[model samples]
Target: MSANPSPGSPRVALVTGTSSGIGAAVVKTLCDLGHQVLAVDFNPAGETVAEASGAAFFQADLTDAEACRAAVGDAVKRFGHVDILVNNAGIQHVESIESFPEAKWRQIIDLMLTAPFLLTQAAWPYMREGQWGRIINIASVHAQVASPGKAAYISAKHGLIGLTKTAALEGGEHGITANALCPAYVRTPLVDNQIADQARMHGMGEQEVIEKVMLKNAAVKRLIDPSEVASLVAYLASDQAGAVTGSSWNIDLGWTAQ
Candidate 1:
């Protein structure tokens, strides 16, 4: 458990992709726990998260380096300093190697991998100055295993694991920790989009896609809850998790167990 902040100390957290799903849940969880967060997304849903949680909201395309830096700067300007960063913004593309569009691959890699790198770089000075920070990258089970027609997503996630480890090693000296959460198929808007894409690609009904494409390899049948992932993110951001860096913690519902 994290130590409670002194009355009015209000820690500042920035959670990306707060428009919906896991990102929204994480913003709520952090707010309920007493952090003043900066919820960010390209979509307008971040404004809702901010309103409901009393967090500040920023609409920015994180794939743009300037936008990424400005978002982090905005949070620091408002909250005094940023204490935690959750890089949860991402998109998925489904295509075989032969058919995968070059542009799509670049877009996915830029959003999923490059954006985290830029955000983390921008947040580093603040964390180092405070000598405390938490950086949680939301990776996926694809970080560990291969899935057909998802080369770019898988590659970016896997690269994120590398970035997490390297950041952990470097940040530890400054009392900052970095880690990645690798969940399987969390019930989220992202997964919903993927289900539709997969169903069409495989010529199967959505139900068939869920059973075979999403859950077939998992030991547990049900999708993981967004709240569960949020709970883990909260723990990781806490003082109790200081020793838990350079790790890829899986919240997959037995997906990788097999």
Candidate 2:
């Protein structure tokens, strides 16, 4: 098991995509655990969410390499160092591979894959210096299995898992651990928008899309709550989970059982 931070010096965490959903829950969970947190997101609106959650907010477009580095710097500047890093900022583009816009593909890859790498590179030294760190990547069920009309998203998520393993391997000697979380559909704004898009694409009602498309693969047949994912994040971030590294934790409601 990992050792907890000394009293009066709470572990500092830097989490991205904090405007809503899993990111927001993560911020709250970390703060409640007595960790100092710096919430980073492209949306300025996240500042309010961060304030409410007792975390410092940094607004940056993580797709930009400089911005990614700046976010890590901002966290270190504010809290001395970052002990936990959550790369969760993501966007979805639902189109067939043939009709997928070149620009959209680039944007998705840049935001989801390249940005995480940039942020990890920037945070590595701090974690190495501190001799303890946790890197939790928010991947998707699509990372393990491909889906139609989501080439860019699936590709980025798959790449993220690879990055997690590499980080875990490199950071092992330095007391840092890295892992990925693969979740099925959650009740997030992003998923809500996806439901709409899928409905449009399939020419079905939104409820039908949710029942027939989103829940079709899951044995639970229900949308996952953001808090459920956050609870898993809490466990992975805990000192007790020190031995867990380079593993992908699935909160997918048995979707991948087949």
Candidate 3:
């Protein structure tokens, strides 16, 4: 707790992509930490997570700039201000560069990279006024390394890291911190879908896909839990983390270490 009463008070956080997995876990974790949360996602499951956690819910397509702006404005309107923002809304398309559809590449980049920029820009005034803010981007190990296929996802994630760094620099002077979490493979709905798609692509079983594809590069032999990543998000949003900004913290279990 800080000398400023509002600094230690229960703050408002807006977490995008709360339909399931990492997003849902982050919403629950922030709520457990006593923050009023606005959980946003295009998926209907976001409503369920919000209800369970006592957080408000909003459905918005992040690829739409108007929708993204409205989501941030609505969070501010409902909560008086947004103290933190978790930019976790993302989608993956596994395809080689030669085979990847141009439209799909643009869509992935728009959601993962462009949307974070818009949300952060929209939220800057409120954060600057309060002299306190946290922005966490959920990037992936692909941001650091590459694998077969997944050209669009990797490119978008790499761009996200750049956005995270630039925003961190600009926000540092305003008591605002921005960072990215690059986790290898988390046991999320996103990974589950990847398992199925990889199985089909590699002619392997789903179990084989997990062992051979997802965990093959990690020193830790298990998929990282969504809750584990959520815990890190909460820590970064805490007052104690004021000094941590403009860094990509890897939760990749040594995937990038090798």
Query: How much is 256 displaced in model 3, in angstroms?
Result: 1.2
Model 2 spans > 4 angstroms off? 1-4, 7-9
lDDT of 1 at 143: 95
lDDT of 2 by residue, 72-171 (tens): 9998887777788999999998988889999999999999999999999998888887788889999999989998899999999999999999999999
Those runs of model 3 whose alpha carbons end farther than 4 Å from true positions after fitting are 1-5
Runs of candidate 1 exceeding 4 Å displacement:
1-9
Each candidate: RMSD to true structure? 2.9, 2.5, 2.3
Model 1 per-residue lDDT at 147: 89
Query: Candidate 3 — worst ten consecutive residues by lDDT sum?
Result: 1-10
Expressed as tens digits, the lDDT of each residue in 95-173 for candidate 1 is: 8999999999988998899999999999888888888889999999999999899999999999999999999999999
Clashes of each: 0, 0, 0
Model 2 whole-model lDDT (C-alpha atoms):
0.91
